[model samples]
Target chain A: MINYKTVNDNKCLVIEISEDFIIDNSDNIKLKDAINKIESLPEIAEIDFDTTALKSWDSSILTFLNHIKSHCLKHNIAFIKDSLPGGVQRLIALAEAVPERKGVRKTEVNRSYLASSVAAIGEKVVNFTKTSKDMLAFLGETTIAFARLITGRYKIRGSILMPIIRECSVDALPIVSLISCLVGLILAFVGAVQLVIFGAQIYVASLVGIAMIRVMGAVMAGVIMAGRTGAAFAAQLGTMEVNEEIDALKTLGISPVEFLVLPRVLALSIIMPLLCVYADLMGILGGMIVGVFMLDLNVMEYYNMTRDSVSLNSFWIGIFQSFVFGILVALAGCLRGMQCKRSASAVGEAATAAVVTGIVAIVVATAVITVLCNVMGI
Target chain B: MLWGFKHLDIKTASITLKNLTEREIGDIKVPPDLTVKNLPDSMKTPHIIVKNITMAYGDLVIQQNLDFTVNKGDIFIIMGGSGCGKSTLLRHLVGLQKPAKGDIIYNVLSKNSDLEQNRQKEINFWNTSAEEQRLLMKNFGILYQSGALWSSMTLAENIALPLEAYTDLSSSQIMELASLKLALVGLAGFEGYYPSEISGGMRKRAGLARAMALDPDFLFFDEPSAGLDPVSARLLDDLILELRQSFGSTIVVVTHELASMFAIGTNSVFLDPVTKTMIAHGDPKYLLESSKDERVINFLTRGEGKQIV
Candidate 1:
């Protein structure tokens, strides 16, 4: 809403700003146009501001005045600012108090695509090595903490262990049951499709039972726990880190690994084999449901077939894999949480990383256990 | 008449400026507890009155029976050691947290009411509805200790946010205002820089710039010099004084820093952590010199290398 009147007062150029000098883009355009006009005017030797009628102004007016101040300076014209308000004078004085440092402002540098790509790859490589080293060191710390825990030398509140065990077992049962059942049904359904072509549709029982007992139950339980319990563990510890609660523990002569990580790892490792056995039963029941209704098989016959298909070694192998998986998931979650940077965003990233790392560790462990069992003729 | 919604019958500080001259602010009859001798008389008006205030978080009471008058243009210090509820008191005053009991009345200059009658209409700031609380908050601004600048936004964008949300100013005008405010705090030409890109002291200055963007009648700073070197802290202190002089806004600072308490504080309340209540109330320097309370004397004289002058 700023309005200016240009008066050539014979000796100097007086641009009198009147009304509210609330400068926006329109005002900037007009001011630029005014500057252009002044450039064309050879008779104008000096620029003086006349703001006697100006009502109220803010930073926009300051920027406008600053613009004129610079214009006069660049053109070797004398600039007078006595007519402006006292606040305006003080403000303009403050703006020019410190000059901007040279080379302080960021000016983008041009680089070749090849150079940038190479640099990025080099940085990623360094990061990968550092991350692997850090992870190995964390594993060593966890092992020492576990050793101390086994010796009954940990500082963890003994009261916390019971609740954590309950969480990983009892609280996890319903979801584990639901997923295992659905997975069993899918396997039966898929096996029936192939077995019907050979007029041996009853072989679907053997397929579902053997798969659940040997590998599927443990893999499913591991993946579920990785997403469920692992994410929760990471989030809880990451938040504790952000709040400096973990630091408080450390300063109070308590090791974070022993007090926080040891119990979690132990609880999950102890409960996961039990959950896998429970999951194996649920998966077999699911296979029985499909066999009884869809395939027109009697309940007793399907049950007997499933019992014959599942051997002691196969069941034990699955339980062993689940036990290892429990350790891996808990370790991954706790490690990422403890390694978190002290920020809200870093806590979120830690939780996400924990889930990814937990699932990856589970898959790799499953592959190793399966190959060892196959090669050793278990 | 700032917001001018027929229901929102609020008069802003700017609208009621001329009426302040007629306000009987000079005759502040100091209660016995607040009387500290050898204090100068000036143009300070009672801005906020906290009477019989009890602040608590759920069941735990932080401070009790708090009664104090914060005057206009006064740099009031809420001084105490750690965990003494200084920040809690600030939160209560700013309406961020509700007091457990009693009233926080804003003393405003009534337009047509008599000077004495105007005291009756002093709005109860503590128990207002959410809408009215938001409007009432416009009279004051706060600079949190962390410099609570939105990390996602650049300094200019951060400063521009409140202006954009409240005012109908054009984007270009807002940007210009943002630059001017930044320059006022010696952050000229750094408008495009994000908070993470700036130094700690610069971020604090940027926060001060945002706090001053509204030119509120009152400003609250929570531990303004919590993490800064001596030179930066001194510069911040000087800048605060300059801001008070220029904007003429009453400042309420919650800090335990003795240097800042001595440097710019005009009035102060000493809250004792152990006593669980305010032990002293007056000018910081005056209390340091004349207070008879052992705890007050000890706290005020802590870490100073010499005896009281």
Candidate 2:
């Protein structure tokens, strides 16, 4: 028997197979409807497939269940496949015995395991604390060195500031602005499509406002900055390290981190906030166009909706996220720079690594923050 | 002075002595108006001291206990076989590596007379400060082995980089300085060219101009004539010598080319790639004559150039 029911205020569509059968062609149009209905109720709690009643299910049934679980999972629901019947349990055990699927789960387990292993490897082979201390010490020294540089204690003229600013800030503006507008347009289009179907066309403004101020603006700004600016920082410093320019700095009584990484980090940190603000304006404007033309909403109405929907707190939160992302980009860039080996190939590797690492960090941070804020009812 | 010398030797892990007494070493006479003290302020401090330095990267050892003094107004050279660690030793001097087993003391020379203050300033000056470091880097210039000028920058922009980064000079002033440096290097009116637009020799010259932009006192050159034709190499060697005479700057060059070595190396260090050690020091011709080391003899008297089959 396939017992399908709505649970937790229709927040979840639970499809339970609790019968002993092969479930051979299991063509049920009603099951598809049940799955579709789950999306209508956004308060999805849990999608529990208590397969304990299932005995000797067919391969197609397993496939359908897996597909359903994945879909529910995507909609932000917990897909729990609880206690299984003997035959089904035996089949699952046998599948786990297979090499490929076994390795898949193994890898899933191994990822977290490997992350923890870094601590172990760092502790056993390397002096974890000492290495950390040294890194921190290096950063500290770099900070002090940079402080001297700014105060002219090292006698560096105001002249050096211009090139760094030009390269790090001014040169980055065009790319940042262009990418922000595109991101805004994309998000607006997506939000308009969904809200239009519901005849809540004016809600497109609210969608764009909330999404841009909460996620897209800061995230896209960060990603763009990482690609354009972060990689540039890494490549610049990486090339210096490989070509001995960094060493030249050392020999000139200059700190490589202070002279190189500090300026980049500071320049990026200062610019990211402004970039986020620009991105927010562009994204909202993009949504405004979609709302006016496609969603049949007036531009003034859209603007008022956006203003009413998004709060300063949300704006601040987005900025905060972008600030964190900016710091991460710089940190990753600088980290890549310092880690670069002295070779031509190593410089390229560091640049690519900085971009990849920066993007990945941004995504993970966004997900975690979004989930955390949701849980906090913020 | 003796203790300091010991420390210096232990730190640099390498040395080059004239060995013929100070009188035998001929000094090139320059125009009296050019004083060594007027060299770029970048070289005021002894940022790095490489003494008796022995370097080995993996299995490739470049030099051992090689002693050399890189003082203000000194233009130094480390020349050897193709596999020799001239570049490696140069890398070591710049703190790319910790000496396998020696000291590479890096610090600015402080003008303050107090020992503690001097030490603090030296350490702090080298340790903390981004702006100062950039100016200092601007103060010193390097012509890379491949003339690794940024591909994105124009010739004028490339030359103007140091000036832009470290000087308050306006764009016009930067342009003037860049053009002047380019002219000095014999590449006038090539300001609009990119690295790809220029010939290899011109690129190297342009690189040299960039290095000279900050009016640096210490210049590090790696095989400045490596891939150039012999005529170009000779011209570069002449340029190196002229730079010394005109600027009174300290230059450290890494080259294995015999012609360039003899042409511009007033004092030199010879590294043996095989043993990863400095088997000879002093004038190139003297190392050829007075040294009992067979490697030195064979290297000096190989009769043919590196191109000989």
Candidate 3:
């Protein structure tokens, strides 16, 4: 609690602060009233602090006293700080030791929403162009490096290449298999339901086979690699960028792209088609399990129908799509990784961007390839 | 003093004795009348000669007209105010970034040859071929400010990577050497820990271990004492001193910490951000006592209120 009184025959204002003047009790104190009283009275020559009755205190009391001190300063009245505790006086002195720097605080600027939106859009367009130029340059460098490798001028150690291949292909097998198998089973079940309405449940074999071989199998593998391998590649390289390992490599006279990115891209390119083939076989097996057991079709009939429905043309196209997807995934992953800023959060954002870019590239490639195939009447 | 010589072996003591002046030997109350011509061969040779280099990022010049020589067995300190391109200067020396102007010449000798047979040969760093640059870089070990350990690799693997890349050492040999390097940095039994698994101090030690994996001729440290407690920083300084004493590797450090600067620095160059060039270059202690530049005196006697015009 705080109380004030006129002292020395109304010449001085004695402010008494007492009993737990902490943050919790700050709301109860009427600092405004005290300020108003000081302003109203012109005869008061000085203000004296009286905290002798205070049981305990904190910054709240210091702030209250500071407010009064500033008011006294403004009005040219004497603020006798001798009556306050030594700690309080020292703290006040310490707080005022250094003046606040100029122009440090940010002032809010009001602008129309349309003006702000247009500015933001212009900034985004500039950023997009810059990013595109960087990506094109990276692509050119990678291509030159790949050419160097082909001519046997650049030698990549087997130790680096082998591990990357194992990571993207062998280590990725279980996930790709699981996802592909489930996709095939869902397609078979859905196709089976419709076929049963026409008393043609046997055609479920053709439906599952053609779908899995033509596009679904490659698409599933592409999506899986995009999420799994692409994200991992981005995060790995992004973290390396953040740690200055890339700088270390450069100083060590090693090209970061050749030593790091090339191996990853080569591994994914070689492994994706192989993974797609494996995924296609697993997906067909999954459809067979449903057709033979649930649909009660003869195993031979289902097998023969699958063999007839899945043409070599479709098989080659599926392989071709997966190859394209592999390159796209690798490019997206490495692009994001190389573009990563030197920070922890940038690594996470790079990984997210890699996955987004990889999946979008896969979808767009799939759409274009399908349109081309339709135009060619294949 | 004799106390400083207590830990020195007889060979190093003799070397130290050859270089000691009357004042240095005065601490032991010894008469300095002996002729001193038997200095170590490395003492006279300059390891790196950074001649009039200008560092910049595009057109924004960080520092210009920098010239210094790092003698072998010298713990050279690139001392300066913050943002004065001290780290950038180290980067230029280490071949991470090329100077916009001027050349850095490295005086290297073949590893197996005797000192008499293989007099130091100068290799202009920037003008050398990629292969020659790689070979030159093999003899340099650098500790970055943030440790920069490969987060994906275990500490053991991080140290072993350089060994594996540059040496034909077998896996077992590489592992043993990696463990030995880790033990040297007082990080024994931490071989299995990844960079992210350890504390910042531990990671810095781990980075030091990796840098020393090849036992490079020159060691570059960018703020080795940063983000460390006073006690830890002191320990790091002692470790750096011990490494220099044991291996005789020429070390270059970039830092602003006065404590470590005074503790380990044998020679230094003070870069001034305002001037975009170095204002003082000499032994930091000597600079503190006798330098006429007010900025140098103010920097050395910071927080002591002893600013002299």
Q: Interface root-mean-square deviation for each candidate?
A: 15.0, 4.8, 1.3
Task: Name the 10 consecutive residues with the lowest summed lDDT in model 3 chain A.
Answer: A21-30
Tens digits of per-residue lDDT for model 2, A13-38: 66666655454454455357556666
Determine which window of 10 residues in candidate 2 chain A has minimal summed lDDT. A101-110
Taken over the whole model, the C-alpha lDDT of each candidate is: 0.81, 0.69, 0.85
Query: Which residue pairs come into collision in candidate 3?
Result: none
Query: How high is the DockQ of candidate 1?
Result: 0.01
Mind giving the per-residue lDDT tens digits that candidate 3 earns over B71-183?
A: 78889899878888888898889998889999898877645444233434568999988878888999999999999887767999889988877888999999999999999
Best by DockQ: 3
lDDT of 1 by residue, B236-291 (tens): 89989998998888899998788889999988998988678888888898888888
Residue by residue across A1-378, what tens digits does model 3's lDDT show?
667789898999888888777776445346777888788888999998788888887887777778888889898999999988888889999999988768857987776999889988999998998888998999998998899889997778786789788999989999998999998899999999999999998899998888898898899999999999999999989988988988877765567888788888888888988998988988988898889889999989999999988899999999999999999998899889988998899999999999999999999999999999999999
Each model's DockQ score: 0.01, 0.13, 0.46
What TM value does chain A in model 1 reach? 0.83
Q: How much lDDT does candidate 2 score?
A: 0.69
**C-alpha TM-scores of all predictions:** 0.53, 0.60, 0.78
The first chain of model 2 has a TM-score of: 0.60
What would the per-residue lDDT of candidate 1 be over residues A1-378, giving only the tens digit for each residue?
334344665557777777777756677786787687678776777777778888987888888777877888898888888878999999989988998978779997677999889988999998998899999988998898878767875545445688788888899999999999999999999999889899887888899999998999999999999998998889878877775456433322246687678889999999999999999989988988889899999988998888887799999999999999999999999999988897999988999999999999999998998899889999
Q: Candidate 2, residues B1-309: lDDT per residue as tens digits?
A: 999998897545322221211222212121221012233534333433554566777665556776544544555668677867677777665444556666554334333454333321222223446555444444457887777766656899877766755668899999988899999989989898888798888988988997887767668888898899999899888888898888877788887687677667655666777666666655565555466676666676675432332
Q: lDDT order of candidates, best first?
A: 3, 1, 2
Greater-lDDT candidate between 2 and 3 = 3
